[model samples]
Target: MNFLIEENRNLAPYCSMKAGGNAKYLVQPKSVSELCEAVAYFRSRDEKYIVVGNCSNLLFPDSGYDGAVIITCGIRGISYENGVITAHCGDSLSSLARVACENSRAGLEFCYGIPGTVGGGVYMNAGAYGGELSQYFIRGSFIDKNGEIVVIENNDMDFGYRHSRLNYEELILLSAEFSSVEGDRDAVRARMEELMAKRKASQPLEYPSCGSAFKRPAGHYAGALIEQCGLKGTSVGGAQVSVKHAGFVINTGNATATDVTELLSLVSDTVFNETGVRLEPEIRIIK
Candidate 1:
């Protein structure tokens, strides 16, 4: 009951790519209880619904979603005790890394600049600079498809390269716990800064785009292959393969959902034809 709900909510602004149509109904719950209440309410009806975080890696269709879109970014919290860190799903990965640094904990330096929320990060097994959330992950709580709360242990996480069990399951992530080790406070901060610098230099952060357009295929790098095929800077309307980083498809100020999707298809097809390796999109296309 304690949440914001609206009709015909525009989703473009919420999207990292700044393109998308809208949601028939949008819900932003401020707490886990409210999230569950929203979920239950929607589940009780024969309505379509989805739980989202940050909209960082999602692409809503141009036609708009005809359902309730529950955004979890409003629910956030973090804490550290006895070498263990706990964070709510809505807490940003950057905040999680900062909490670890302030507590003199290491191993989370790679998360310093990740734009995804805790839930999204864990869902995708997000990683960078040879470090992944799964390496430090302990366990998490979630709401099942039936709206029942459950705790899944570390052993049950089923984490893989850029994936987790949550990818296939209709479960809603709530809060998660991760483990860390003692480290020099200054050293941890320095590491975080180093990674952030690398990110800024390599990524096309100046424009709106899903962080990485394609997953690395087998033993080859997606960006390198794309660039090798001379697909960088190629555009389909306002969506273009970033010249700075071929792995990203950026919105050139006025891109639409159709433009981005068409560009993604073009790039993937081109890459496969030239390199013999099919590129799979990393962003979730929600139609």
Candidate 2:
């Protein structure tokens, strides 16, 4: 009931790639009650809706979405006490990492440079530098499709390579609790700095991308396979496979969602033809 709704909202500004078309209606609810109310309101009217976290790993089509887009970026709340970090779904991963580092925690350093909310990271089981969210997560709270809050333990999360069971379900992550061990504060900071430096050195961080475009192929690297297929630097409209890192497809200014989709399809097909192994896209495309 306390949601702000806007008409003809531009979706690009909300997303990392800045390439999406407009959303017919956009809603931003401030709290759990407001979010649930908005969901119920939409459902009562038989309207379609999509929930967006930080909008980092999504590509919205050029045709635009006809339904409501509920953005959760303003729902952030974080608390740390007794070696436990409890963060709301909208809390940034970078912020979470900083909080952990300041508290002498070591497990979350790998997420220091990740550009997404805690909820999105958990949904994707996001990992980097050989460390993943699953390792530190103790439990998560989510709102089911019926607007019921449910707590799921780490074992029930079913986290796998860049995916969790939540990806296939209609649950909306509300918050997460991570358990960390005490370590040297300075050492934790140093580790985070080193990981950030490595990310900057190897990735095309200058452009807008959804990080790795594809999951790693079996027994081989996705980027290496793309490079071997001579698909590096390939472009479709304003979207291009990054030359610096073939695993990334970047928005080189004025790119459309269609462009990104086309380039991804081309890369996947080419890689499969050359290696006889299919490449699964890591970036989620929303219609």
Candidate 3:
């Protein structure tokens, strides 16, 4: 029992959307052993389960989740030695990037502005400004459904644009090791600052959003397609396609998950109808 289990907990505070129903049960596991214990406990009773990182890319239904919501945010740890950086699943991407910069490492600069955990970034193969996590990733550790720790190499991860093999597996990432080259600390800091400035300038940082709303379609940009369809600033309830960036669907205060879903559907439909190309959501919707 490494986790303190709570009953009927409100989930809104845990998600970036700041709008979600309650969870029948919630567990925050602080370590790998504790995490395994919680998983085993849930499995013994044959209960449904879902693991969450920082909840940056999630939208939980208004009806709430009927099973266990396992939060891994408390399991944080990060270290660097011999040019390899090891980050626990709960370690935030911003923290990791800062650590890299402090060590004068150069590969993780693009991750400086990404608001999520290392586990979440690895799962999504997170990228920005021509740099992706997959480039620096060397290997990772994951706990399988049976509570077995397994190590996987970068090639085995099957990383792609905003996706990885972890999405299909019943495995929980424990930690990851990345390889980075030594660089001038000043240069590294400058690059990170530049990326952060670009994000602040181009994204709707003032509103609540799940970053990019849709995956890039083949032969077309999702935002360009959306803007072409005249869906920018279009609203459904409190949710709206951002006027600043058509690729973002923002919660303009008090937006429900349903509202975001409705807006996403409308945008996808309109874009598909206009461009003959279907857009896929990058945001993960959970119920």
Best-matching candidate per TM-score: 1
Give the candidate number with the greatest lDDT: 1
Residue 101 C-alpha lDDT in model 3 = 90
Which segments of candidate 3 are over 4 A away from where they belong?
none
Q: Return whichever of 1 and 3 wins on lDDT.
A: 1
lDDT string for model 2 (1-287, tens) is 57788998889988888898889889988776777777888888888898788899999898888999988877888989999999988889998889998888878889899999887899999889998999999999888877788999999989999989888998888889998888889999999999999999999999998999999877999999999999998999999999999999999998999999999999999989988989999998997
Which residue ranges in model 2 land beyond 4 Å of their true spot? none
Query: How far off is residue 237 in model 1, in Å?
Result: 0.8
- Tens-place lDDT digits, model 1, residues 1-287: 66777999899999999999989999999999999989988888877999999999999999999999999998999999999999999999999999999999999999999999999999999999999999999989999877779999878989998899999998889999999999999999999999999999999999999999999899999999999999999999899999999999999899999999999999999888987999999999997
Reference-based lDDT, each prediction: 0.93, 0.90, 0.90
Instruction: Single out the weakest 10-residue window by summed lDDT for candidate 3.
Output: 141-150
Each model's TM-score? 0.99, 0.97, 0.97
RMSD of each: 0.8, 1.1, 1.0
Summed backbone clashes in each candidate are 0, 0, 0
Assess the local accuracy of residue 217 in candidate 1 as a C-alpha lDDT between 0 and 100. Answer: 91
In terms of lDDT, the poorest run of 10 residues in model 1 is 1-10
